[model samples]
Target chain A: MRVLGVDPGLTRLGLGVVDSGSPTRPQLVAVGVVRTPADESVDVRLGRIAEAFDQWIDEHRPDVVAIERVFARSDVSTIIGTAQASGLTMGLAARRGLPVAMHTPSEVKAAITGSGRADKRQMTHMVTRILRLDAPPKPADAADALGLAITHLWRGAVAGASTPGKEKDVLARRARTTAGTGLTPAQQQWARAMRAARA
Target chain B: MRVLGVDPGLTRLGLGVVDSGSPTRPQLVAVGVVRTPADESVDVRLGRIAEAFDQWIDEHRPDVVAIERVFARSDVSTIIGTAQASGLTMGLAARRGLPVAMHTPSEVKAAITGSGRADKRQMTHMVTRILRLDAPPKPADAADALGLAITHLWRGAVAGASTPGKEKDVLARRARTTAGTGLTPAQQQWARAMRAARA
Candidate 1:
């Protein structure tokens, strides 16, 4: 399956696509950043983002759309803009009938570098190794976008694995993590990612 | 001029329209809320909001779009959702080539009521009176939506009025409010509303 990951932001939105046909060796398909002028009105900037993202979706035609979720508790100045940008991505993906997956920054970091506390350099290094690329994707955000796609792909593999023992282990781990009823599929997949990281 | 005001939210979005052809006697054209099931995914919910808001823009064809700005510092739990929903409104308005106006909650309250610290009841009362409605718009969000439109109308009037003395007074007040250069028109209009309220 092909997955498109977006690290959402107002001034600079990072987008990366990965073809995950081989779960063990995901390949990078595209990576770039979409930037809007800081001087533009919020309305115009958002509209431009939606337009550019729509074009990305049309061109990539990925099976799933993944985004790094924005946390309201983090960076009060940037959270709102990040959330707004992510909303456009989510809405666009839904309109296209594509499944939307969201991973927290920590989750993506953990999945990529085996440590939720990994720094940017570590994540970029790991992504370069995993994708077998000559160099890390430019701008930390672009690497983060690729990391989100790889995270989603691995979690999805864990979720849909036919190995009964591994599936049972994942379910047990997810049961402990969920702690509440009615978790979304993406949330459940995050739990699976957490479990796989621990294993 | 016709203005459509949107009080954006994830579960309940309030929408109101007013025809301000006569600066002194604004008339209500439409008022209601758009609701999405809380159980739905964020992507689905945002998509639904965009679709419904597009229909609203097509149906109303307002000269301007007004929305209450979401602050990242306020109510961390709901701030992200509010920002995301408001983003859709702004993006839609921009795509249709309509000017988008944003008023802070305090600014909206001050414009509708005499005080920036006015309570919800005061706002509802003033909205009912301003729109000459027999009763207050049901739900506080609906009243707030109308308040946004009314605020925009009054501010737009203040910004465009040829009264030299009043324009000079507004410009002086706006100079005080704007700490730096490059304020958006909406920001300048907000300053004008603050000046008019004081007057």
Candidate 2:
């Protein structure tokens, strides 16, 4: 399955496409960034981002879209822009009948590097190794986009599979590393319940 | 000039349409709310809002669109949703090549009641008086939406006018009541500069 991952931002949005041949292996299809001038009006910047998203989706035609979930706890100033950018991505994907999955920073880290608290350097290194790229993707955001795609492939596919035991193992591993997941109380409870059910 | 005001929100988006026959006079064309259930996914909610905005713009054929300027200082949980909704509104307006104006809560209050710090009751009263309506509009969001349209009509038009002196006088009057106008530092400076130039 091919997945397109988006790291949403107002000034610079990162996009990556990955084709998963197996649950353990995924190949990079493409990676790039769409930048909008900070001087531009919000609407104009959003229009540019929307156009970029349309072009990427049309060209890549990924089976699913994965995006970094916007959280309120982060830098308050950029939250609104991040959310708006993420929203545009999701809306565009939905318009095309594409299933979209949102992965938090921690979730992406854990899925890619086996630690929710993994730093950017670790994430970049792991993404390079996972994709078997000769060099790491530039501009941390692009690497993050790929990480989101990888996370979705690992978690989403496992969850959808008929193998409940394997799903439980993945969920348990995720739960153990949920320390920095930035999940809401309700979400944490839901995760705990799922783990318990699988147990 | 006809203006469509959008009070952007995820759950209850308010919309108001007004026609300005004169700078100080605006007639209410219509007012309504678009409700999205909390149970729906974010993409679905945004899609519904996009459709509603499209229909409103198509039907009203407004000369301009006015929307509330989103602030990061608001409730953190809702800020993302609010920004997304606002982005959708702006995107749609931009796509149609319609001029869009963003008015802060203070600006809306000031335009409607001549007091930036006006309470909800005062805003409703002024809106009722200004529109010559028998009763105040239901739902505070709808009234605020109308207030936004009125604000844009009064401020945006004057700013773009060829008469600098008249614009300065109007802006000075607004500045006098700037306590609730929520003008950013840059905006305040721009207003001051305009007043000085006219002087």
Candidate 3:
């Protein structure tokens, strides 16, 4: 199935598309970013985002939409904006009847670079190699959205290869490096809501 | 000088404008949000963001633009996207000869709520009281952008309040919180950076 990964930001929203026709690997189809003006108001900025996202949805029509979920711990403003951004992505996917999945920052790193603490440069460098791109994706944020797509594609393929009796839970693909490591209790509650939305 | 504060995100970019004539309290002249569709391609998203931002700038000539700075220590994709988002805001501000200032999540919290660990509800509540608004700003994220503007005004006021023989370093605020403890070298380095950013 075709997949679209998104790195959401109000000022710059990144998009990457991967055509997963083959079970083992997906081909990069397109990647780009959306920008919002620093001068506009919150409502106007949100409107701009909606319009840009709609155009992409109409063009790609992907089966699955992957979004980078923000596990916000502090900064009420940051978390609220991130949550709104995530909400916008999910709302659009739901409107189109497409399946949506979210990957945490840690899960994304482990999938792309084989470690959760991999830096941005490392993730981009690895993405370029794995996808065999001509150059690293520009505005690294867009590249990251693409990376999320790649991670989901690869994990999905790995799942396809596993035996039915021995398949692992999709979320368990990464190992936590720190003790007491897990989504915060509140975030876990959000995860349940997201899962239900996907179902 | 007129200042614009932006709370960036994918689907909604919140923008708030305040002309802090006295730097102690800014007058709120404008506020709004920009929205985007989920399906747009990367390029289209960028276009919309630029177009929207440009339109807003043309309408309101802000002398300075303050944005919530992205933390680079987190996930690479997020860091990259945040960096890109910061670039867009900075670039837009530059186009209009407006100096740009970036504040971290913690600084904004401490400036507004008197605590860096304050949650969204608390910040919103505080911003409302500070702005003397009839109600909390809608969509929560928008309220935050406004709060950032309020913070800049208050911070500037404090800076302006010093006389020839007087000074008000952020150390006083720090001492309020760190009254009994000594910080490590690394923490001291961070404190300097945080102060320089005026966050």
Q: What is the TM-score of chain A alone in each candidate?
A: 0.81, 0.80, 0.76
Model 2 clash pairs are none
List the candidate 3 regions with Cα displacement exceeding 4 Å. Answer: A74-77, A160-199, B1-199
lDDT of every model, 2 decimals: 0.82, 0.79, 0.65
Q: Tell me the RMSD of model 3 versus the true structure.
A: 15.2
lDDT by residue for model 3 (B1-199), tens: 7778887655667888877653333466778877667596433443455567667777888766778876545554444334434445555555455666767778789987779988999888877666656888776778778877777665554444332323233454454467533433333553443354333
Q: Give the CA lDDT, 0 to 100, for residue B67 in model 1.
A: 91
Ranking by DockQ: 1, 2, 3
Error of 3 at A82 (Å): 2.1
Q: What RMSD, rounded to one decimal, does every model reach?
A: 7.0, 8.7, 15.2
Model 2: how far is A185 from its true place, Å?
A: 30
Question: Model 2 chain A, poorest ten-residue lDDT window?
Answer: A190-199
lDDT of model 2 at position A51: 79
Relative to the unseen true structure, what is the C-alpha lDDT of residue A157 in candidate 1, on a scale of 0 to 100? 68
Q: B50-126, model 1: which lDDT tens digit per residue?
A: 88888888999999999998887788788888888988778768877898988998988878887899998898988
Please provide, for model 3 over A87-142, each residue's C-alpha lDDT reduced to its tens digit, 9 standing for 90 to 100: 55555565556777778878888877778999988888877766667888776678
- Candidate 1 root-mean-square deviation in Å: 7.0
For all the predictions, what are the DockQ values? 0.58, 0.42, 0.02
